[model samples]
Target: MNYINKITLLFLLSISVSFAQEKLSKEDAINLALENNYGIKIADSNLKIAKNNKSILNSGYLPTLTGNAGATYNKDNTEAIFANNEVSILKGAKSNRFNASLNLNYTLFDGLGRLYNYKQLKEQYNLTELQARETIEKTLLQLFTVYYKVALLTENVALLTQSLKISKDRLTRVNYQFEYGQNTKLFILNAEVDVNNDSIALLNTNQLLLNAKRDLYVVLGKKENPNFYVDTQVNFLTKLNKQELFGQVKTNNVSLLQIQRGIEISSFQLKANKSGYLPTIGLTTTYGWSKSNNNSASFLLESTNTGLSTGFNFKWDLFNSGRTRTQIQNAKINYDIQQLSKQQKELEITRDFNNAWEEYKTKLFIFQTQEKNVETNKRNFSRTEEQFKLGQITSIEFRQAQVNLLNAQSNLNSAKYDAKNTELKLLQLTGDLLNTEF
Candidate 1:
């Protein structure tokens, strides 16, 4: 009985806890978004299609075998004439015919076109995979940003609530002082206004937090409980070497690698097009059977045949009004354009890396500065509040100190998250974001 009661009590406690506010960590949010995001799902489907298209058979590198069969039946009145001028007529005749064939075809040589085509298919598959990875990286970044935004707003709401409490306490103190004729009517009115403003600010912050959560749900591609709170602490890399990072990004960045693959694919396509100017050799074999039966008033005849044959086939464009040449030239031009695109992508990646590095440094400095400001403001606000209580400072001065502290805290929060944001961008550029936990 005691064990059963313990189990029942634990189950109830678990249920109560589950109904409490949802707590989401940064890693959890990223994992959920990656699993459920519609964009990632679509990219995965496209990757599958590319894999299917990359099959060697689709590239025409494998032999093809096919089978076909047919049957026919006919009934007719027939008349025949012989060379001796004798004529004969049959009242009704019936005939049936059947035919079947199995055929095989394989490419013997095509100027190495099939080999190049197969290589292009492989490159295309690689491009698809790179594109999918890029999508995932982008989605993770967006989720991380929104998750931090929610955390920032949640902190703001907390600060404002604290301010509101301070204002309320001030109002009560002012009212009591006014009753005793120690404080002025103006002081009470001002305290009331401060309390009202803080209330309004807290409400607005709550709404903004809710909206941020909604945006997160969109990224996650699902609806979740709205009363969730996220971890507010922001983390960022403390040290980085720009040169080492740049070298890693040059080879690891998805967009850059994709462009490189594009160039390779275009090169293969150009070679395959050039093959059109040369002759193609192929082999074909066929095995077939046919049977026919006829019935007449006085006689019946039946015939059957079976055969196997094999041959080599050759084809050359010879000349097609320069069409093949035009195609080959176009492919070459595309290859050159892909090369140029690759160069452009490399430049862009370098620029992005430099910019992200600078931004990370700037935000780190700002966050450090804000951290100091928060500590100083906290001390100043504590001193001012004590002074106001002892009648050493005006209510207005105390309120000003409180507001300053709140602003300083808000700035610190923004700085910390912004630093983290830049850090994420740097990781993304270096192709390390996917492996690192936010």
Candidate 2:
């Protein structure tokens, strides 16, 4: 048993090692998220249902045909008395009966109700398709957001690790100086505290990175694998102007398209309701046959019948307590609501686009500022280190410079990711999120 246990443990370890070695790139992550996302799967299922509903066969465009067959058997005894005092008796009288029929029905006209209903179904089918695209775009946006978050946290871990290294190096210098009677014991103590603090920071940052990777993996429909890691590099966005963005958003946004479809669907509904005020015409045809026999006596009695029928049916609902009118009115109201909703959405689009645009600009500025800050802090930290070594500055001043550099790097990472998020939002608004190469 112990041997088997050992083998199982070894196998699990190997699997973990393999996962650890697999480096997930951004494109791979995006692809996996798209393919495995539960939301996308549901949307695909709904799309299939819509396509099935859109079929002409479901729209009442074709005639209906039917066939039926039946049979029965009976046995009975009977006695009959005549008016002239003559009597007749029969026993064990058996009879068999069978019948079959075929029928067909076709609607010749229904005030064009069928046509309008078919149009509505087609519009609904298109609406469902748009809904699926909306789901895909939203899911992709969420994925990209999480992916960038993981990248930011990864960068944070690296930053803290480097800071820890710097702290340890300073601690070693402080200890050496103290042994040479050139530095105070307090300096050594503070140096050790700095190293400890940096270590703690690195540990916390590493935990955050792990949590983020778990989130990404869950979004990709995978169990949390501690060894799973994504690329850490930050991506910058190209310049975009508000005018071009607004123009694209108005024409291509999925939400707007859905609203337009809503209007179309409402119009079709109104047309269908109005159809009730017009006369309807239909054609029906049927053919039938029946057979019966009695064999209780030597003499045989049998009956067979067959017939064909064809006819047209016409109906007009002159009034229905104004129910049809009410439905039409309701449909009109819904159409108006959809129009208003579309206007509201257009406004929302404008607001969202402007918000994202301004935020992109703000993040861009902050990123640029942090870039310059990092350069300055780098030079300042270098000078501080030289001065500290020459006994021209206190260890506290040197540590302050190191902290400044770390702060600059952290801020830069935040700005970088912030800008990426805005860019993603812009892509979603402009309907470009799905078309972009990950």
Candidate 3:
């Protein structure tokens, strides 16, 4: 095996019970999450509602249509009053009335309030659609982060298994050496402790990896799931600059987009509130038909009345206890606050990007230094082992060299995965990670 391969195989044999590779790429995970995640579903449902409600504002422009029918019977000992100065007193009277009408009322104009509302709702629907897109991006980002983490942890567990195997072999060697008076009891004890430490570390990493995998599956909304394995051989170097990355992040970060939508919605609402000051003009028309039969004195009379009337209506809130004005002011304040929130979110994104970038760079340097350290430690241990085998060095000195080699290998593996993770975090923060393909 090549040096890296040898070290990897050894570490994995020492740390894991089994090592298997099953790969799911970043794109696949993100697409699945966006399609199935709960947050995305909620956003989609709300978008549907928004679309259904948007046209309600236009209903005011449509004519109001109504129909009615009724019949009544009455009797009285009465006197009736008439418009023509004619009145009658009767011993008994009975009346039957029947009426029916179909009416239509179209608002010829409504102070343009209805028009404003229709425009506003259409814009509101667009805003809701933008919100849904925001949710999708967020879910995708989260999915990528979890998926990559699981991948890194799985690699760690495999490497640690290899380490455990080497420890076991070393333990056997130590016992043989002691029986021949070539090693001490303390040497055997150190070997056993290293093996135990490797076992414990393996357990912890395995559990963490399992949790990450399960979390990803749950986010994908899968009720039944397959064991996840991720590709760890990804190249960390890429062509991404802060400016381009930041631009993409600002566009794709859904929370920030949602806040921007809130600002727009609130602005329109403020405009709607101020509409109360505008004169509202309306056209109204009424049509009626009625028929009645009267029984008074000795004779019965039937009468029918039908009329259609149309008129203009105007409502100007010339003055009210400042209700509309206060509402407008409050809406403006809300709009301003939303804008401020959006600005704050932008600053936070910048900070997050910077932190992740620094971490990745720091880990990358550590990984490089540790890589050389492992190779040098292996060479030194080999020379020291030769010296001890020739009886020029004590058993303890030889064992310490072996221990240093093992520790160096462990450190190198850890730094490799840590650097990868930090790079992943940087990509995630900048919203570029979701687009990352294996």
How many backbone clashes does every candidate have? 0, 0, 21
lDDT of each: 0.87, 0.84, 0.74
Please write out the lDDT profile of model 1 over residues 1-438, one tens digit for every residue: 553234335434633653687788877787788789999999999999999989966988789999999999988788877677877787767888999999999999998898899999999999999999999999998998898899899888778868877888998999999999998899998987887777767767777987998998899888755657799976666567898889889879988889999999998988988888889999999999999897653244888899999999999989989988998899989989988998988888899999999999999999999999999999999999999999999998999999999999999999999999999899999998888856
**Per-candidate TM vs. native?**
0.92, 0.92, 0.75
Clashing pairs in 2: none
Q: Please report, as a residue range, the 10-residue window in candidate 1 with the lowest summed lDDT.
A: 3-12
- The segments of candidate 3 whose C-alpha lies over 4 angstroms from its true place after superposition are 1-24, 56-63, 73-96, 178-181, 184-189, 246-256, 285-309, 342-350, 367-438
Evaluated against the true structure, the overall lDDT of model 3 is 0.74
Report the alpha-carbon TM-score of model 2 versus the true structure.
Answer: 0.92
Instruction: Give a tens-digit lDDT track for model 2, residues 355-393.
Output: 888888888888889899999999999999899889899
Q: Deviation in angstroms for 137 in model 3? A: 3.4
Q: Model 3, residue 220: what's the lDDT?
A: 89
Error of 2 at 348 (Å): 1.6
* TM-score leader: 1
The best candidate by lDDT is 1
What ranking of all candidate models by lDDT puts the best one first?
Answer: 1, 2, 3
